[model samples]
Target: MSTQNYLVISALGKDRPGIVDELSKAILNIGCNIADSRMTVLGGEFAILLMVEGNWNTLGKLEEAIPALEQQLDLTIIVKRTEARDSTARALPYVVDVVSLDHPGIVHQLANFFSQRKINIEDMATTSYAAPHTGTVMFSVHMTVGIPADLHIATLRDDFMEFCDTINLDAIIEPAQR
Candidate 1:
């Protein structure tokens, strides 16, 4: 019987063409499958976080191959064994949208509010752009938050709205359609 070995791998380095090509080639050479991943350019650097699965021998080969790729590509790489998790959606999902005039600490304050309330932010993205015609700098955040089954929905919504009002942000919380 052959059981799969799962790994969580992270790579970060100066952004350039061929980073994904080279890194993925290396993983493929060892017969590993890239199961789930997130790749993005952060400032001048490229960041990658991926989960891979393979058999024992292939995974061992991958361990030996990573260091060479690090040197050749000028990358910082980290790998760790991870237990496989079910990807099926669980818990109630809600979408939180916020818009406000550009200002410091907006993300931090919102994150703090969720953290204090034990809310899980499953995914989030933020962007800054100039409002049309007005030329006012505006910041916007879109996030998917997972609300635990036991939490009272109305109370959370009320509290979140109150906090947003205090901070002068236009915000909305609604159920995320699956």
Candidate 2:
């Protein structure tokens, strides 16, 4: 079997219609596969992170084509070579959900909590919005964390709950659904 080469591509530009179509079409035309991707619009900017896979030649072609792509799409593009994730380090995936009155440092605090415990935060998303009735600003966070298999779940949950309480945040830690 042939080995696959991977490239991580990130692009940012003014948001508009057809950006995804054009970008994706270009990748396809270059004979590369989009293994995984995240796309979003933040304020006025369209941002994308893509993991592309192909044989050596195709990936080289994609890299060579990037400057023109950036010019055509009016985007800032960055590309980096990467390999597949190591699967030997096993862990249990847990979902952490938090909501509280909007305040600064929530993300930092959460990051600290996990960091102190040596847990890996695999993914996270946070948003703030006004409450329905009072229009009070509220912030919410959803995170996927990798808890080392050897860690005790019950103890971790207790500690997480207590930590959240101390910070005036409502939170839950549960096994992630497969």
Candidate 3:
């Protein structure tokens, strides 16, 4: 079997209607497939991260086209070649949810907690909003972490809860749904 070539592209620009359309069309036209992507508008800016798959020649073609596409779409585009992820470690996926009064250092502290335990945080997102009824500012964090298969879940849960309690954060850790 032939090996697949991959490119990770990140683009940022002013929010506009046709950026996705134009960018996707360009990829399709270049004979590359978007393997995975995340696109969102933050404030007035549009940001996109895409992992594209193709053969070497096709991906090279896409790379050559990036400069023109950036100008046309009014975006700052970055492209990097990458290999597919290695899944040999086979870590179990777990989801962590946290809510608390809005404040700084939550993410850093949470990251430190997992890091100390040698857990890998695969994905995370955090948001802040006004709480209902009281209009109190609230923060929420959702994270997917890869736990080593040999780790004791019960002990980890106990420690995680204890840490959260000490920090005045409501949190839960559970296996990720397949």
What digit string (tens of lDDT, one per residue) describes model 3 on residues 27-138? 9999999999988889899999999999999999999999999899999999999999987987999999999999999999999999999999998888999999999999
Q: Residue 12 of candidate 1: its Cα lDDT?
A: 98
Model 1 residue 82 CA deviation in Å: 1.7
Error of 2 at 47 (Å): 1.0
lDDT of each: 0.91, 0.96, 0.96
lDDT of 2 by residue, 1-178 (tens): 9999999999999999999999999999999999999999988999999999999999999999999999999999999999987798889999999999999999999999999999999988899999998999999999999999999999999999999999999999999999
Estimate the Cα RMSD of every predicted model relative to the unseen true structure. Answer: 2.3, 0.8, 0.9
- Evaluate model 1: give its TM-score: 0.86
TM-score of 2: 0.97
Off-target runs (Cα >4 Å) in candidate 2 are none
Instruction: Point out the worst 10-residue segment of candidate 1 by lDDT.
Output: 82-91
Full candidate order by TM-score, most accurate first: 2, 3, 1
Clashes of 3: 0
lDDT of 3: 0.96
